[model samples]
Target: MADRDSLIADFLSRTAWAGARRAPLAGDASNRRYERLTDPATGRTAVLMDAPPVKGEDVRPFVRIAQFLRGAGLSAPEIFAEDTVYGFLLLEDLGDDLFARVLERRPDLENSLYEAGIDVLAALHAVDPPDLPSYDPALMSELAALAFDKYRSGVVGDANDGIRAEFVARFRQLLEHAATPERPVLIQRDYHAENLLWLPERSGPARVGLLDFQDAMLGHPAYDLVSLLQDARRDVPPAIETAMIDRFVTRTGADRAAFLPAYAVLGAQRNLRILGVFARLGMEHGKPHYVDLIPRVWRLLQHDLDHPALDPVATLLRAALPEPTPDNLQRLKRQ
Candidate 1:
């Protein structure tokens, strides 16, 4: 810890924010920690990202994607200074107007804020993506299995490995069949309200500030849209979700028939992955609070499964995983 502090001090010392006052910021599920750095004299502020390399966190993907998004006219933070080797970055502080916070304070602005965010996705999808790994069926299927392996297994003594293998094989087939493999768009895997900032002063899609995009990968356009609408952290009103889906389809000229199914599949895949992740975070990582969010995630999963496109896999999931009842939730927390 002392060595890390010295590294942070030295990194800031060489930069324009030398001797800046620092205050810790709330971190996400990842190992990365952030701090707000304020210049004592000028009062200017920048965000300090302290991603320890020892924890297997890398800053290169973030730097690369931030530059790409900014170049594409979106509001990804500007990189002020970086120490790739030590995994520290001085970034533009986009401020406290996160979409979730703004909506909580001013519920009336919900529609406009959500619309702008959807517009950003449309704009991003219109362009050709940079070189990045594909969030392919194989990878996605593997991740979705975490639902059975972690969440289900943790809740109900043990899951049948044989059933898990069968589900994954069938789920992968569904994914492969539904996906438009030829047309891939850059998807910010965690593109939801919590990661979005409402910068109303800026015009068009630029009004939405982007964050937590280091895991961006090439996937179906509907993937990020699912992440946006079926959020686990906060409830996006059903009316708003429907209207935004219409808005995105209109803007992007996507076939409603083809798009809706892909949206459902992606949502199912993402929510299933979250179930496993939340369970693992509580049971193994000692972050039990995430277990409280399981009910919302389970609701979203059920909604996704109700879609006719997921009929084949829905029964399998339902039979395999137990419901997140109050008792089941307690079981997770107790772990």
Candidate 2:
């Protein structure tokens, strides 16, 4: 704890947050760390992001996406200051009411909140602005590959090799289900129960504060919808999911018949990817709590497999993947 505090202090000192009264904000799996600081000059609260440059991740992408979202008039975190070299940034505080906190405090409000969320997603997907970049299929494939590399191959036991094979084979087929030319939109890959926040100060969809948007991209409209509806961490009610999907299709002017299969496949794909991520986070990252989320996500995959609209893709998942069994049962239990 002391070491982390020292690191935070040193990071703030060398970056834009120097001389501010810095305190740690909860950090995420990414290398970024955030702190709440008092801006000495303005005497206002500021959000400090410690984005150390290491590995393949860079801070510039975060800055770039923030700029793009802001240009689109999306409610993104505002950059208050920056240190080009060490890659620390001072941003405006969105608020403490992350969707997670809101869910915890007012579980009953989910239906209304999700309705607003779909509206935000509709707005984001509707934009074809010149500044935003695309999230091509190549990136989607790579992200999906993480499941095979990190979770299925490494975490699933040798006894369940066939079960592992089933998932991988089906995962490939699932990828094929939603494979399409890129669409233009701001896609926050990790949009889910945690990233969307409630801001009563604002109205309707704008009332939701967006976060962890550095990975935002121009991708399939299905991507963000799947991320929101088939969330691994929480069970979004089927009725609500159905209503919201209908609303999104209407709101975004997407063809209902043409889009349903795409949405289902993408949702299944998102759920499956999270399964692997949860396993990887457990075994490799030593964050085992994520393992508990695996079964729920798998259930979602199964749901997609059963979706009549997604029969082609569902057939693939069913064919490539074996029925659940003790061989797979023990593996599932291990998670």
- TM-scores for every candidate against the unseen true structure: 0.98, 0.82
Best by TM-score: 1
- How does each model score on lDDT? 0.93, 0.70
Candidate 1's TM-score reads 0.98
Lowest-scoring 10 consecutive residues by lDDT in candidate 2? 321-330
Clashes per prediction?
A: 0, 1
Runs of candidate 1 with Cα error greater than 4 angstroms are: none
Q: Candidate 1, residues 93-173: lDDT per residue as tens digits?
A: 999889999988999998998889899999999899998999999999989999988999988988779989998998899
lDDT digits (tens) for residues 59-119 of candidate 2:
7777887777666667778886676456677787887888767878899988878888898
Q: Which stretches of candidate 2 lie over 4 Å from their true place?
A: 1-17, 39-43, 130-134, 155-182, 309-335
